[model samples]
Target chain A: MSKRLLFVFAALIIATMVLSACGPKASTYECTDAIGCVTVAPGDPIHLAYDMVINGPDATLGIDSRNGVEIAIAEKGQLLGHDVQLTGEDDGCSAEGGQASGTKLAADTTIVAVFGTSCSSAARVAVPLLSQAGFVIISASNTAPDLTKAGDPNNWPGYLRTAHNDTIQGAAAAQFAVDFLKVTKAATIHDGSLYAESLANQFAKVFQELGGTITAQEAVDPNQTDFKSVLTSLAPGGPELIYYPIFVKAGSLITRQAKETTGLENTSLMGADGMFSPDVTAGAGDAVEGLFVSSPDTSSFSQKYNDYFLPKYQELFGSEPVSIFHAHAYDATWMVMNAIEAVAVKDADGTLHIPRQALRDAMYATKDFQGLTGVLTCGPTGDCANPKIAVYEYHAGEYPPIKVWP
Target chain B: MLRTWRQRITIADVVVWIIGLSIAFVVVYGSIKTIEVGKYNTRVWIDLTITGLALGGVYALIALGYTIVYGVLKMINFAHSEIFMSGPFTAVFLALALYKNGFWNSHPYISLLLVTLLAVTVSSTLAVLLERIAYRPLRTAPRLVPLITAIGASFFLQYAFRGFFGSGLQAYPELGFLKGTWTFGSIPVYKTQVVVIISALIMMLILYGFVQLTKMGKAMRAVSEDKEVAGLMGIDVDRIIMLTFALGGASAGLGGILYILLFPVVHFFMGFIPGLKAFTAAVLGGIGNVPGAFLGAMILGILEAVGPSLFLDGMGIAAPYQLKDAIAFIILVFILIIRPSGILGERITQTKA
Candidate 1:
């Protein structure tokens, strides 16, 4: 009996060692294989990575968006009883750079979720590789309508964005034009790029739907200097408003020219999220004084970001946060951690079991989770529908949000 | 001479002319078709003249750098583009820092002027140092050696800037003094456009005078014509070459500062395209010829500005936007194939032994 008991004890000890070796150490939840989706064991440290463009010309809001993500990640640590590590990748707001950053992150097995690609152009290139690799990519500001359209068969399962689609913003701008401003005749100009054209088309469709006449629609090259002839030709029968869906560089030039030729000081000029930067106001000077632009209001989360991340970001970057892209980057880190925590399961013998599909499903299952962008609930089509957008009027050399729309 | 001139229009010339005409016709036809389609509510022929002029200013500024260096060294300085790009990046950062510190808001013009002076000084110094360190070592080496060194230097500077800056678009803070629009009927010309044109013309005149009239400039020409003979005559060939690069670098730096004022976006790769375009301008104007480079830059700029809407868009090409680059290259290839000596290049002569 004593020899039989000794043999059983020895077998049990050997079994425990083998099981522990197969699983990640109990201290941290690490994904080792492609089998079952793994969740962070209770009291296990989780590593998360948020890849996004942090620096660049188009990164005005990117900085703020990243901060929002960081704040959420910090908050998650205090509430969820798990330590989280966050890392950022600068995509330079270019498609080529975005692809490289995506590839780099996907190759790193520790990065389970990615939060950025603030520009729709960058997102279009990054989504396929990240999704194919089974990493969840959630954009905080990508608002292209086709991205989440269920009608499109090529919809990515792992791709999502917290911002409202251009369709919604377009309709809102149109409504504001027709109902609020009571503008009967309007002209629309786009910078002849995907993002600009997409927003312009959506606005045109909605403007027509709301019984407004679009007198002129034109496409301008972004790199060109003189926009006089284009602006002159656009001046037919004196349109009451000009809807320009373009970025700051071209938009500033257009605004300055529009004011000079068309007396835009008397006419109301409106634009989309691309025009909502201090650079626009500065570049356009007093020409953009009355210009009204609409974008998602990230001001509510400013205090939260400052409280959690200002000291660290300032310590490193030595500047006050400029944009909201930073907030989105920060949230991307938390979202991945949340996914890892939800699906990671540990066996009795300390073996971690995780399936890639389960982590993806958990990302879809996220509901009513309070994120820095407000309460988050990703829809079946991978869109954060009904995000609140705000309109700001440039006055006294600053943009102050005047109204919030549903 | 007349018969030779007529026969000089070779098969290559005919092909180039035909291709150019065909492209022009297609663009005109497309514009008409687009108007007929009426998918767009408004159809307006965007004026190419103004765009061409503005583009020419940039081309002229960049071409001057190439021409100046080529005139002195008889070798293409491939690293000049990187020098140009560095100017804008530095200017933007300095301007921003100054703006943030309240210097710009108080005296915008003075601050900008100071920035420009600083940018020129820094760029000129860098240009001279680069020549002393990289090119001077390979001065007596094979001609290909210096050319290869130049290419390497260009790449090194580009990547080094990228690594240091962390590869994001740097948005320049606006200088209020440079903001305004001048309109001719429906045609609107920006203040930056005026600045670009005026600055380019002024710099070109100054450079032209320096090369043609100044003692140092005459010495540069003599060295360029025959470095060995000029050296024997007691002229410091190396010093002249260094001065030539410094002047070119200053011009490029000035161009960079103006460019950022217009576009307000700067990056490490910013110099690559502009550099190539500037080189094209140099060849177009007759590479070693200063006035020719100026003229060629203007023409090229105008072509780039007006070619898209007038030629490409008129041909029913949906996105004639990026076609500017292709159009420029096509022109470049045709010029090379048909007119190897360039539009204003001196004809080469052979002497019987």
Candidate 2:
């Protein structure tokens, strides 16, 4: 080996050390972060990655959230004198999809922050990886309590969400069922998905606590087509209302088939936010009429949502929001951007250094942040929603259902 | 007879027999217990049975594709599911157009016919193309080669459709005529279910006759029995094989339409579950036997519908419906154990080699 090259390397290191000592000149950026930093060179875009389901049955959920993110990027074209680049992969809204996207996103060190995972099942497997990667991870529509519960196995640090925890949404639905609907007996069906399972269980627990009889608690596969037998079995219980907090496909099938079931002809059917897409009306046809679904009450969203943001969204996307989470997604994107702005260090040369740990701290420290879906606040473990759930009723062929209960 | 049986049976055979009998006993006991409990009425059972029969009809149509293809090619056309998907998935656009223009309700029969025809044509064309492009080149390759290619072809077709149609559910329009109930004596049946059942039966009968009573059907059986010998005796083996694929695919397409009638939701990935069930049905009845496929599909359909409540409910299992698919696979295991050749599967031949 050459002694000359070794001497040159040593001199270069000493020179850098001396230069760093004089970094107070405000011309150079020093990264004193515990974990590391993402450096965006001059004229390079500040890259933010997303891991959301972009295909399949629940594509509406993820694509809508992504549209929110896209809108946010367009609104904030430049951040701290750098272009904001949004790039990412699809999670497919399944556990395997989560693992695949997680592994891929984790390996890419360029990502400054990430937000996504429309479904709770995907987030259960994906969040831990993104969290471990030292990126501030947020979700737009992951409502399962397990993701945000303190010290739970599925919960991870640096993961926060703008979506309401199911504890609030589920109990609210139960209360409405008992107090408003005046239904003494009810049934619940879940598709065995983490989101649906926990949500249905929460609804059942709260319903029983509210002096309502849970006639039956059942489960179905998300891919299952025939719900006639299950509906038939629920008949003996004489449930006045059947609350199925499942996704669109199965939810629609149950809604249609429930009407056909001999004994269940008179039973009222209800679903949750997961089933609150316009697709439900199309999928269930006329049976969608009188269907009740509990979702985030859009009426309570900050005024800009309707006055400015929605108009901008319509102009940009050429359609109404397809799913319920777009506003939540918009808030999540702004939260990430604001956090990045709070922690990132800019050099006079136009390059920027974003310390990952400081970014996470800034995100978790959020409070009274005025954004869509109401004023947002983050808890220690990661719950950060000003949750306002309301139940709405659908009349055939019409959507954006009228909120019938508070 | 006992001494001869003792001489023939091994320890494994005895073990299998005991296990099979125990499962059988549990099933019988469960059924008895459910009836004794009287939680469900005769009406409930009747409705469930009718639902099962309607769905079973669709399964039979899809299963015919698998059974007939296996009979001739000795290769499981794993992509037959996609062929089933291509038909209705494409026809949905036409159906929607008819629906949006108010022609669907005004002329429900024409709409059904048009959709069915488009679905059949699309399915048959895809099946033939799949045979020519994916399977033909690998016919002489190792057995696993074509099998693997079929799976690859299946994925290719699925994503290609996804690319073309976008990965979202395409809701099929409901016909007004197919709404409401037609009471059969004291029992009431939805018009859609009746249509599905009748259409499935007619399709199955037509397919069975075409395969059994036609001259080309004779040539197909000869080729399946001995491909090289049949070819030497003036059979166009390649053409016969393609026809087999077309026929199978057409039935699958028709089956898909019936499937939508019952379920009413269509998508690029819709074919996956039904395709899998139909394959299982084909294997259950007997892979190469048409009638056996139909019988297997009916049993499977009925079991999936009634087994959960009838069997599991008696055993005090909660949410038995979730275990519905589990019951289907368990019954398949039992059937294989008791009769590994399936209800009517022929003995494995040199064709398998």
Candidate 3:
């Protein structure tokens, strides 16, 4: 009877263990077939990978982040008294690019953690592959809410981002359009990508909730050059403002055509951070004048970034930083460096031992870490930075956009 | 009635019928819904018609190039769109230079005329060059050989243009005269649209006169009908073919400029869709028929402009603009299934045969 009771007890224990494994908690240390854990050995250099948009239309977003990461590495000198090496891969700012970059990075078990993915679409494919391999990915400028959160079914536990979510930017844009501009009728346009679509939807929802009527909601093909018909179709409704949060090319076309379109000339034109670049000004020429853009709060950035980093960056690169997210990238790199140091095990034999799981844990436990962008305290779902969205208005032939809101 | 229809139908016929019925259902359903929606009134309808006509005018000009090429070669010149693109992409530099020098403002008419002349000349030269280099060599090869060569040449020219003039989007300098709307009786027409429509119409008339009345046009018609027989009869088939290409190229270049005028943005990839729509217009009108291309383009432009709002908006569809491309292609499929020989049927081809 006792023996029978022991067998039953053992069976119950086994069942409990299996049940717990299948529970709601995300798998952390489990070595999945797709991605196995990587460990650091003595005298071996710690590997950090960067997957970002290095070429194509949105190259500025990635280039800025890469510069920031390089600066951070220069400041750190080394990690855990061992040399740290970075492998750069281009995400191309597309899903296929992300999958290709992620696949390449995952196959290399030496890489401890990744800092990347300026665009959210790239991160969507990359985070999962990195997560499965038990590698932590920290993004500098992935604003799509689902990248590091549960709302996106593909969200992995290994993904953490220092960038503020679109929820804040979208809401702030809606508030500005309604409260500041005092426009009650508005239309939102998206390019159907997760980044643009989510931001546009959020803006529409908030705009409607603020008692402003949403005149129209529209989506354009990213490849579409002409927006005249779409604009004309929406014109009779007489939207007071047209909020198009899309890329530079499409955004420029829309802005230029909106001014030229018969009924749409008086309608205010606004864009999101996707259009916040020199490219828009260059593409739209004089048409982009008086355009409003919602972007990350530049006023909150530390003066050190301006006084020291700016000149240093110009001196090193022979040009100004192309776009925003450089400071966020700098902050993300330091967080990874700090996390690595906190969990690193150094032995008397001149060998350093860095466990991948412990390093991820250290990153999540990050609190009150003073960074260039903000005082970051990583939340449960890996959102570290507080929301700070600002709106800027562009003047014709201007280099820096004029800040219009706090 | 169903049994009678089925008894007469072959597998191909049945397949076509199914596709036709499905398309008809969607279009009918959407149109009914749109008509019921009170938001779209007569003013909106009038505005959409103007917009469609302006777009169709440009498409018709581009379609002329395809019809001419097809008339002589009996092959679709897929690269003709790139030929159309090269003109406006190159003309922007002249426009920018004129604007900078204050010539654009001081002599707007002369400046516009000069820009058009440059675009037409360059486009004609490129078309002649394309014939000599890409098409001439492959003329004697299999039908597929020249077709493939045309496709390759199209991509090469696009990228080569991109390399020459950077990939960034270039905006045409805003003409002061074309800035505002020209209101005619409660209906307001944009100045740019008026310019595009009038210019396109004038160009089309000149082209029609050139093909119908000129000696070179007679030679082109002869080469298209029987190249060997025309050659035997002392007609220079090669020269006529090159001349035909030049005419198509000139028209395309002008079309590109008008396209830029209407939209005010120019890029290397600008010609691709317009080129495709022109080809569709050509096929819809009858590939070898010039007047048929014009008629088809007008129909296509109007349908694409008003179809979504008129058909889908009343159905309570969300973001109907997203399906605009689908609407254009659906019409293309309908035309192909219903009248494969196009609106003019094989009458144009039989004239040559």
Candidate 4:
């Protein structure tokens, strides 16, 4: 125990502490794009993260989206010779969860892009944080009209959703009821959610503008299981069609009670993408047999991708995709990858440098890029994919919905 | 005169006056708006009233459990909600099984009876166990100890059930007989609503008779008056307390079945709100008073059902129905502020004092 030996021990402890405290080196990067600067050197993995609902009731939707992203990554062996690594964080389909996941992902500097979130409500909370950090987010599923509409109302400059906005879905529904079904009168109901309320309002407005009378506009507490009184109240109006763009449990109850209730027994029922699930059909039982649902054109994915994607998805996940929007996710993933490759600076030694702002610009510059879903073109507002809405009818004992409208 | 008025009105008093004035203004504004917007449909108003009364009946039954437990123990049995939840949650399995066997649809009344009995039995057993296990050990502890323990027990039961049954909302088996509406001239009353109102009224009457007339009821009253004196008088206070819990549990169980009849979806979180609303009703009625709890529950129920559309809709507030739960608490806050002892609670306190 000499003084020299003790000094050597102290030096070793300090060295260990400093080494453990140090993180990835901060590299200086050449700045060009408007938002801010980001650094990625050669040999660094192109980092991407998915912030979506991976659990809870909407797990199927997010799981399919994740699967699509994985397939896209597999298709691209590497980005500019650097391997691509993807990570996931669950937003739990809640606002608070979105903020938490967004904050965690934003803290990591190396992540060049994000792909998610599955629902509009989650995106509402995540978008501002991610966009402020100069990261581009490409969503495969979020279809709320306000998210990427003109004005970028939520201030998510770097946000883009491949999924079609509910405006198109709601308008398509109104057209089908007004022109095809020839229904003269309609009623719309919402569960007081942003998605459903907006969709219902859009449908009502469109229906009225098209020479169709809106008999009643109603809002119900989603938690209340007994819609009998509400249905009975709405019955006197005797609407030819009742459009409710709500989620599973409440939607199922409405479909069943709307049939059983005295006045609404003959009323035709219509729902939106939220109710277009096997879960809803199972819950509603025979009552949902003839119910119409409007959603994106899921069948429009290219035949080759359809052939390769389904079998490959099955081989990977060991099951069929439970929900729609997988192809949109695949397209979004490739869009992000292609944007990264276009903007990255490659060195002679196989090192890659990706500027965050450049990547965001490249994503916004996407034009008529061939995608599995269809042709993709980035609009001025950052709505990268043009949305096409289709209507499907649920017949009893049918697994997939029967396509009824073009 | 100005000096005198200023001397009487403190800042605290001013704040209270402000809140009171704001609430009054809002209520008045909402009422006028509702009247203007409600389109004067007599039949529709009648239908809403009927639904409110039926819903109130269910609330009354649940409030009784709270009232009885508070009467004897002077502790809010927060876990009593999970007790109410237990019956309907377990009864769904029996209901589902019966539906699978075709007996539910074939012999509807008998199957309903069996389901009610199952719910009551489970609720009673859980209540007794809750008392024996959670509350018994801390009986002599500070009042807060038992109350906190009751809350912990409630969360435990909720999560336990959630784990056991999975977190999905299970729809109650639809009774064929309860689906149709009974028309009284222009006003149509749902068959389920009629059943709920009648059953609740009958159960409350029976409970009143039992508390007034039975031997165990006398012991309960004596113990509630003063446990030491009741013990000195040779009344088995412990037995009376157990009996009280059992009775309260039975009422909650009955309320559970009637509740599912009116609102068929059952879930782990179902008990939390209804249990809380019933507690509010009990407090509004003056917690320890049975008849007061019934009356309070009925008033609460009607207000909750018709208040949103009738009161708020008139004020041009969008989505009034979403604010239904808030209305109940506003009434509670107003009642407590104006009448601290509740509608019937003052008399019982006077007698005891």
Most TM-score-accurate candidate: 2
- Say which candidate scores most in lDDT: 2
lDDT of 3 by residue, B1-353 (tens): 99998888889888888999989998898888788777866877887888888999899999989988898889888899998989888888999999999999999988888888888888889999999999998898999998999899899988998889866677778777777789888778888788877877787678777777998877777888888999998998888898889989999989988887776677777788898989999989888788788888888888878877887898898888898878988888887888899998578757656
Query: What does the lDDT read for residue B344 in candidate 2?
Result: 80
Residue A174 displacement (Å), model 2: 0.6
lDDT of 1 by residue, A141-177 (tens): 7877887889674368788777778888888788878
Clashes of each: 43, 0, 1, 4
Assign candidate 1 its CAPRI class: incorrect
lDDT of 2 by residue, A28-118 (tens): 7677899899998899999898899887888888889999998888888899999998888899888999999999999999998888888
* Model 1 lDDT per residue over B1-353, tens place: 99999898888778878887776566567657656654334223333465467667877888999998987787899998899888877777788888789998899989889888877876788789899999998888989999999999999999888888855556666777777677757666667777888889999999999998999998988898889999999999889988998999999889888777665667777788788888999998788888878888887876665555555543456545446667766766666555676776764211101
* Candidate 3 lDDT: 0.84
| Candidate 2 similarity to native, TM-score | 0.94
Q: Per-model C-alpha lDDT, please?
A: 0.72, 0.90, 0.84, 0.82
DockQ of 1: 0.23
**lDDT tens per residue, model 4, B1-353:** 99999999899878876777777787788778767766536666676677678878888989999999899889899998899999999999999899899999999999999999999999988999999999988989999999999999999999999889876667666788777778777666678888999999899889888888998888888888888999999998888888889989999999999998876767787888788888989999999889888988988888776776677766766656667778767867766767789988898888788
After TM-score superposition, the amount by which residue B117's alpha carbon in candidate 3 deviates from its true location, in angstroms, is: 3.5
Candidate 2 residue pairs in backbone clash:
none
**Per-candidate DockQ versus the true complex?**
0.23, 0.71, 0.38, 0.23
Error of 2 at A375 (Å): 1.5
Cα distance off (Å), candidate 1, residue B182: 7.8
